[model samples]
Target: MTTTLEQTAMPEAEADQVRAVLEYYWAKEWTDGLPVVPVTEGYLAEFLAEVDRDPDEVLFSITHLNRHLTVRLAAINAAMAGCRPEYFPVVVAAWEAIAKEPHPARGIWQSTTGTAPFLVVNGPIRGEIGLNSQGNIFGSGFRANATIGRAIRLALINVFGLHPHKLDQATQGTPAKYSACIAENEEQSPWAPLHTEYGFEPTDSVVTAYVIRSVMHIEARHTMDPEQLALDFVDTIRRTGSLIHEYTSALLVLVPEHAEVFAAAGWSKEDLRDFVFEHATRPRSELVAVGKDALSHKTRWRLSSDHPDSMPDTAAASDDPDTVRVLSHRSSIQIMVAGANNAGVSAVVEVFTLNPPREFPFSYSRIERAGH
Candidate 1:
């Protein structure tokens, strides 16, 4: 069956000028509560040529709904998000990453918790496209970071019908739903780039997508010792409201200064992960007190099976719910470096667990230039 946009007439909105076009889309509820750049056949055609991809070429399919997003439609969304043709490839790669079933992004899109995909870029394309890797990387100002991320949200709305109160059921959506993209500060990172850790070549560009619900920024300037620095992160991750017992995944984005602490002591990313996994815990009694018993035994079991050495000290006394250890596995933690150098500031973005019947694993996709 034909699934590409090329086989159908393009949707049109009448307008005489750019302002009219923005107003039209805003009125039609086709935008993310913000004005969108006007799209035209002429502009979209130019964007299509950037990758030389067929308008009908299907990049990915949303398995649950049997929906396909074609290259032409993606370009249209890219243009609508104010992305230039050169930024189209990164957009495609981000979509390809989420489109996979392994990533299970559709669950994230439809959930009431309102999770958004956090895109992290690596390699030459980061510098080439001017993606933000430092100094308010998560904040606004940069065109490439903002628009590249916005393009993905637009594609989700236009192609997948994730419209608010329609397909999207976010109870309290976050501002991140608008746009969230950042590049790795590879030159400043103490360890290899994220993509490299995933086994990609250093020179290759890649986009790693995480379904995140919230961000927690922390400052750890009290001590320069690597272990002490790790304790600070452990404390932050174990916050009472974080639902630690139902742990899914956590991403630690270290600023250059914080990363340098570990690098100077010859600590690898793995060391930090191990440290966080060991120390980032809360009392099981707290979970039961807060009506989280379902997580109590199961999580303890998983922790023992996954990291026996790090298992809670009170496992022999299962009823002693006061025993701490919410984060069950080291694999649930991911590490990377971003933000400006010379500050103890860093952030942790958490990807919460999905409700019953829709667990999707974290995933990554390499960003290959269209011609490459």
Candidate 2:
């Protein structure tokens, strides 16, 4: 059996009456504290037609709240977020990524730390839909980038009831919470596109979603030496507050300038990830100084209780703070290219750091084409 929302059409109101509709919805607290396009029956139907999917098909379920997300409701929220009908597929893919098992973003939406699911689009759809992967890629300007991300946020708010101060209790919410989506600059990338790296063909579209706690921007123009550049990035990771202490996902968005340096010197994406993972370290004493007890830190990394391997022989004997690995594993570091091809600038989108990662692990969903 299919589930469909009852046809709720707005009354025939002239342009002047638009304000009343907006005000009524706002007063009802149905918005994200922002103006939204009214989702009438006609508009919702138009969006659903683009996907040709069963409107009642359950995409994912918020079991705690007894809420099952359906395509029709997604279309309604997409329309309210001002998305074109064609954008619905990408929205569905993003939501599916977040709902994937072992990485479901159940608690992330309401965490005390301000975290938001940032979407990264790959493949032909990015160019087909005019998703920005160039200059100002992470900034505002592109309609597809803004509204597509906003559509997901709208679904969380209107459909799943993730309202602020209630389901979403972020203490100091970030501006990125509104919409943080961008496409990878595959054309400018020195290596393969993200989808290709994930084993998808070049033509297949893909979307990845992760709950980013914060971002760290890096500028590597001071020196062209590869070792020096890697040191700069490794130090940044070492100093940054990682949500998880070990073997977790961290995204590095390398710009053309930084990527070119590695490409010219014969360094692949794996090379970069490995180098950073090896160098991103601190002494066990450093963790102790930060109030992370040595015993817990060892357990966090799964080190042997009797023979901890994180600390160097000298550091362990002397209680020095210069011999522990900060980043957990090499495979957890993901690399992508974006931004203008000019300066040595980059950004790191960090994931949450739970000792025992319960929710919000890195997730990816392939974007399905209509009629495929």
Candidate 3:
């Protein structure tokens, strides 16, 4: 009797087929690892309908590939990221911010430094979109938080061409890559939302980009005295161990709990800034070990206003083993935003974007245009 050839099961065959296709494409270096939903006209068109942006409009173009993302391409990335159509504007805005030259997208993504972008949102849309800022905000479970974060990461990967092991040389990237979107928790914040602090109107939506290594919490319950609170900040900064590049910017997020303490003590934003400035100085010697040496020539062993022209200089090739703690001008703190609802605890995250002194006014991005 003629033996019939064994047939592959349909489901098994389908799985194998998909796997084979993925392997072939990836082996040829065609994939970003995460299986991208086919960004077809149909799939992207629906996203466009929600945002109602012009397909030809250039939103943001990231380096080399100079992937100039139009509304349609952003929609494709947004759809694949599982974002609500309304989230499209936020996604585009963030992309534009990171792509702006100083954002260091090329350096941030490609450097062995394990830094990643955090999308901090402000404006009325935060309340409208239900982005999380309360307890467990970083934890999974919030749709707005998840998708807004995903949209930006996908844009970086797809538009900026930061495929892992190729362009993105992160030594050990964090799970934040999946999504790191957080709102100002405006309703809960005692001060203005982040956008307003950054000079946007209360009704305007704005996104700020920062390259953060980790989110560190400075415990505020030690005491309610604002100076004591400022001292707590001093302790954290002195010990932070952030020897990043001179231009790296750190995010100081105030939790509502701690904000209340400062507010009750009648401290203005300038007061906190000045306190952080005074207590945050580090000996330049301690810095040489951690940073890229880009600004060592300019940093002082101990920064002082009276001694602005001269800093305690340490040689880059100095053989003296004990000169590592030179003090430099305390790079000013930046872009403060408050989060949480309880009003007792807050956070200060050391961002990797700022370093060196910048003289020009910094804008988060071209203000988010209302339309495309």
Candidate 4:
């Protein structure tokens, strides 16, 4: 995990050789439409040294694509993404978490929804590797966050062969495809860190991976009331374009200021989730209006007066077919605190729902540093 590369022999190359290397990667489509750092033996060795596992260890494999993401290949991509050697462990952890996903993740990369692998890093590793949890957490500037995420994307392109129009059939891709890694703003958060909610200790470094379709920014600066903020989030979640299926989930990235307002109002994350699940409804008629009525009934969570057992306490709420809840369960909504406290801005990342419904939609892997 150390940055020192004293053991590796990194020889300086001529200007022509550097240009040729860049051209070679571009021609081979190994890059993500950006200039990549040449993956030399020296750089690869430095990255590989940070991981304790075998270099040929298969972290994950896409059987259809006939590709296996080995530890050695991951290090090569991490180096090409301009990641520091110290950041290699986090990258490795991300792939491990992705590999644990219950759904066929290859579909997530190749689906027409244009979904991207959204990563959330928690615990001590955030500060250890200079990951940004504050101010422009999703934007450019932080090298660790940018490159670690980019490394995964590069592996998807080169190793999995998920190029734009070929295996990846994303109609219109999202900008998050470039890089979508962020650390939890634990210091500024009102609730426990995200990993803790999944039974991980606060002391342990962990990486959580989710396949997300798009990021919808929520602005509630005008309101200080927790209910009002919840209403705003409900509006964003219940939007027609945001609704991919009947049983949808979302990652609510709350800024410190907004989370503080909720905390002050004695609203926990569970309370917010309940509130969102109860209020984020759009009626089946609206879906019909949007030409989604046919697809709505295909889900197991579809509610109707005839199927009272579909949802809990069906008699208590409106039994009308129009009363369609956007989220399947209260547990579907995951709230995490991130971003600077400068604004009341927050984000709602729509999670990709698998057809069969994955037993575990999100996967977490503990970050293991070199030697340990």
Mind sharing the TM-score for model 3?
0.75
Please write out the lDDT profile of model 4 over residues 179-221, one tens digit for every residue: 9999999999989999998899999999999988888899889
Evaluated at residue 109, the lDDT of candidate 1 is 81
In candidate 3, which residue ranges exceed 4 Å CA deviation? 1-40, 246-248, 284-331, 335-339, 359-372
lDDT of 3 at 202: 79
Ranking of candidates on lDDT, top first: 4, 1, 2, 3
Off by over 4 Å in 1: 1-16, 101-106, 296-324, 354-361
Best TM-score goes to which candidate? Answer: 4
- Listed in order, each prediction's TM-score against the native is 0.84, 0.86, 0.75, 0.89
Provide backbone clash counts, one per model.
1, 4, 32, 2
Candidate 4 has its poorest 10 consecutive residues by lDDT at 307-316
Pick by TM-score: 3 or 4, better one = 4
Worst 10 residues of 3 by lDDT: 321-330
Model 3, range 199-259, lDDT digits (tens) per residue?
5787787877766677767767768787888777656655625544333234567777777
Clashing pairs in 1: 285-321
Please tell me which predicted candidate would have the highest lDDT against the true structure: 4
Candidate 3: Cα lDDT at 50? 60
Query: Tens-digit lDDT track for model 1 on 83-150?
Result: 98889888888878876634443455887878888899999998897888988989999999999999
Q: Rate the local accuracy (lDDT) of all candidates.
A: 0.78, 0.76, 0.62, 0.84
Q: Give the clashing pairs for model 4.
A: 283-322, 284-322
Q: What is the alpha-carbon RMSD of candidate 2 to the true structure? A: 7.5
